[model samples]
Target: MTNVVLFSGFGSHGKDVNEDLFDRCPDLDSAAADILGYSIRDRLRADRGAGPLDSPSNQVAAFVVNAMKYHAHREDGLTPDIVMGRDLGEYNALEAAGVLDFGTGLRLVHLRAELVGNADGAMAAVLGLTPEEIRAVLRSAGLHGLVFTSLNTPYQSVLSGRPSDIARAEEILLRAGAYDVRPIAMGKPFHSPLLAAAAEKFRDALRGTTFGRPRIPVIANCTALPYRQEITAEVLARHMREPVRWHESIRWVADRFPQAVYTAVGDQRLLLKMLRQIFAESIGPGPTGATSRSPVRIPSY
Candidate 1:
């Protein structure tokens, strides 16, 4: 059987990778850079000479996607059977699957970051609480501002809201029998309506961009389904303001690709670690006869 490899590209980390790969593979780098430059220049002309800050997030995504494609093509030789991503990583996965072209995906990513950056609230990771239980606690506490950002696993979830709302939700979860409620280091509440403006801006931007069917399957964060031909920039735009169905996405992957080897292609290995915990029994001893550490770095093929 052909070994299936999964690649979830990096977020901010991809910026550096783009530079590094440019030095190693000039032709690939040039091709990727040309695409990125065209995207930026077009944006500038449309906006009437706005600087990078006006659309920094999309610019970053464009750069990252180019770099990721370069790396994947250079190392893997052929596209993998499946690709997935979480939060910002989803854009990278979309690029890999050929759903969103490099420029468009990058543009969305840029909007996502800026929108997320504008929020002044906080987020936290709550462990040992089922989704039902957490929802019950939120309801009981009357915490109106809180949003569940990630369904990471059966017992682990990430919550986002105003600082006070988050604190209240945390207390309620702990009081309702959660094992741990810890704050995440991230400064903003993502996957919430708090970034509605950003999502709207992205929607406008998407009006001009085009999308094609994917060459490989892409698991979407909002729907947790394979990318369909019907998927439009409008649907992707809404994903910006919707919570990530991470648990469902993972279950989809596990159910569909039982024999595939999963790898998280980003700076943080948290996604891989979570996958191991969720599918501990499914994973077997490798050639080294040991459980693997997550966040496997993609090497040059």
Candidate 2:
């Protein structure tokens, strides 16, 4: 079976892999810590207080930690045929595909988080609602600010926009038989046109960074296809303001590789659940031969 490595976004769980990474690669440890605004160990030990992991520093830290775990797996001689990242996890995916070095990826994430920090919005998952259903509700309710953000599966889609709009939409969706309308633990409305200004600013910041051609087939969240075009600053910036077409991306994988193992590289099974949902929604028993698994948590260094 073909092996594919997937990654989830920030605000997920992490392991104490920093100590070992520092011991083995001090220079890299220092650089990662500097970019993250604290020792990797310190942030991991910070308060578990919730609400929006949108801060540039927190985003950078998450990226660094995930990147470390990915590298640890690589050092152990596991290579992926294709790497996919959801939202912020894209940076780690790029790093894994040899498109960017660890430090470079963290730096780019720092800039992205900074650009996104000024925005004030909320995100929520609208379960048991089709994209068309959600769009119809948005139109009928005249909730202009509410926007469809990420499409996790046919039954699950994330909505982002003004907090009040989201709240009102939640009530409407519930009345319309939505399985659940749960708020995401985030402060900013990401992957929506509301962040178009942030996307423009991020474009400027990303131009100064280096993005190499991927060594492997790196699926893009925007297009749900391989990274065939030039990996430009605009392309990366668009992710901030565009929906993460995760369902399509996963479908692409399933169609291409009938016998494949899908693994999430994080401490949470969030992405794994989404993968299952996508498969569940497929027509006619849906890729019964495909395999899905929990996040592969790499041991500390």
RMSD of each: 6.3, 3.2
Cα deviation of 125, candidate 2, in Å: 1.0
lDDT of 2 by residue, 124-216 (tens): 999998999889888988987787789888999999998888889999999988989999876689999989998988888787877788888
Report the error of model 2 at residue 235, Å: 1.6
Q: Local error of candidate 2 at 57, Å?
A: 3.0
Which digits, one per residue and each the tens of the lDDT, describe model 1 over residues 248-269? 8877866665556554565434
Worst 10 residues of 2 by lDDT: 292-301
Best by TM-score: 2
- C-alpha lDDT values of all predictions: 0.64, 0.77
Q: What is the lDDT of candidate 2?
A: 0.77
